[model samples]
Target: MARVVVDVMLKSEILDPQGKAVERAADRLGYSTIASVRQGKRFELQVDGPVDDAALASIHELAESLLANTVIEDFTVRVEDN
Candidate 1:
């Protein structure tokens, strides 16, 4: 079995309205030192493999295909010995 970790984040140019809204509210509450806040997603998975380069490539494809939207989001992949 192989373990995979995926981190998903929003594109920088895309407006993070959620973060902006939160920052405005916090400032109103006297937390103005905070400049920004971004929300992201992290996912973990287990797969069967002898765990070679092919397996790793397939995992990346799966992440791009189902978990991440290539246009507005970016993703990083990590593999761990398990």
Candidate 2:
């Protein structure tokens, strides 16, 4: 078995309203060090594979096709062997 980790995030050029909301809250809490904030998604799945390069590619394709919308977001995938 292999474990796959996927990180989904909006493109930097896209405006992140939720992130802005968090930034607003941070500012309210007097956190001056936080210059910006962006919300993202994280997903981990156990895939049936030997954890090779091709298996990793399949995981990436699965994430791109079903897990995330590419119009405004990007995804990165990684696989680990068990």
Candidate 3:
């Protein structure tokens, strides 16, 4: 079996309140070196066979259509090493 990973994140122009809250918490915890934080979502899919170019293409389409909001978010799809 093969594993596919889909990572969805908001566009840079979009405000991330959850990320900001995390950053603020980090600062209060004395993590001064922490710069910024951006929260995102990750989806893992298990495929019955090898992940090839065609599979990647299909996953990309799935990410675009179902996993992400194209207007304000971006997503990347990749195969995960076993």
Among residues 3 or more apart in sequence or in different chains, the pairs in candidate 3 whose N, CA or C atoms overlap within 3 Å are none
Candidate 1 lDDT over residue span 29-82, tens digit each: 999799888777899988775667887788799889988998999999998766
Q: What's each prediction's TM-score?
A: 0.75, 0.87, 0.94
Local accuracy by lDDT, each model: 0.84, 0.87, 0.93
Q: On residues 1-82, what C-alpha lDDT tens digit does candidate 2 reach at each position? A: 6688899999999999999999999999999999999999999898764777888777888888988889989998876455
Score candidate 1 by TM-score against the native.
Answer: 0.75
**Candidate 1: which stretches are off by over 4 Å?**
24-33
Each model's Cα RMSD? 2.4, 1.7, 0.8
lDDT of 3 by residue, 1-82 (tens): 8999999999999999999999999999999999999999999999877688888888888999999999999998888888
User: Scored by Cα lDDT, where does model 1 land?
Assistant: 0.84
Q: TM-score rank, highest first?
A: 3, 2, 1
Model 2: lDDT to the true structure: 0.87
Most accurate candidate by TM-score: 3
Model 1 lDDT-worst window of ten: 47-56
